[model samples]
Target: MKEKYPNLHRMALDYLSVPATSTAVERVFSQGRQLLHFTRNRLSGNSVRAFLCLGSWMRHDVVSPEDLIAIIRQKRKRPSE
Candidate 1:
């Protein structure tokens, strides 16, 4: 069928590549909403962006807590008086 209908076949493949549900996107949005709640509204935009990126990475197991701690330790700054 693809040989006879190449365009239709490509369209079908593209459609299939899309997610069947929005659950993953919705979860990300929900997490962002929780992070930006009233009590935390004072967070700077860059801080929020960092938090969200870190959360996503943690959720996906791209970075472990130990790894993150090590990275922080490596970048820690000495107090300047």
Candidate 2:
């Protein structure tokens, strides 16, 4: 990576402040597992995806309602190309 993009390598090193490992992400998945075990219902792939995404977001800091609305608006404007 340094050889390919020295500037990018330096920038990444400076910008990335979070942990490199996926340990936090794995904990989120563990929460999903516990939820499934308690519910005991066969969840479809899409439902699982939604639950995981929601759970991750919920566990983190709350986004302002206005920020969420703006995000939805921006997402809607993008062409499906």
Candidate 3:
């Protein structure tokens, strides 16, 4: 029916693309909470976001330690900073 009702078909596809479970989201929150506890509670929002993204990627094996090191090195500030 996609040809007959393209908008409806697109909407259905979009709806189906969303996750059916909250497990992944809950896991991220759990990890973030642990990371932000106690001494780390002062972390800024941007720092928290970066840590979450990097932690999630590392946990999922999406990027290796060497890759992370390379990324850090590439972004290192010059002496002028």
Candidate 4:
């Protein structure tokens, strides 16, 4: 296929590589949208990423609420240099 029609083959590869459904991605985006809407633009990019990751982790039982609180406290106590 590549040898016969390089351009079409490249185009097909590009188009076919995309996912059939963006449900998971859209779900995450929706979550982020809700989060940002609540926070009202107070969060930075890094903070948003951290919050999203933490939310996903908590949802999956990878981190508990207590653990998250402890981690936040520990970070706050660390002196910035």
lDDT of 2 at 41: 70
What is the Cα root-mean-square deviation between model 3 and the actual structure? 8.8
TM-score of 2: 0.42
How do the residues 38-74 of candidate 2 rate in per-residue lDDT, one tens digit apiece?
A: 6667898788866665444434433345676798899
Better of 1 and 4 by TM-score: 4
Which candidate's lDDT is highest? 4
Give the Cα error of residue 56 in candidate 1, in Å. 1.1
Q: What does candidate 1 score on TM?
A: 0.56
Q: Estimate, for each residue in 1-80, the C-alpha lDDT of model 4 and write its tens digit.
A: 78997645655554355556899679879999989996579889999877877686666565689987998899999999
lDDT of each: 0.73, 0.65, 0.72, 0.75
TM-scores of all predicted structures? 0.56, 0.42, 0.58, 0.61
Q: Candidate 4 at 35: error in angstroms?
A: 0.5
Looking at model 2, which ten-residue stretch has the lowest summed lDDT? 55-64
Q: How close is candidate 4 to the true structure, as a TM-score?
A: 0.61
Better of 1 and 3 by TM-score: 3
List candidate 2 segments past 4 Å from native.
1-19, 61-81
lDDT of predicted model 2: 0.65
At residue 72, candidate 4 shows an lDDT of 83
What tens-digit string does per-residue lDDT give for candidate 3 at 1-81? 989976556555543455569986688689888989988878899999788766655655655789989877888854545
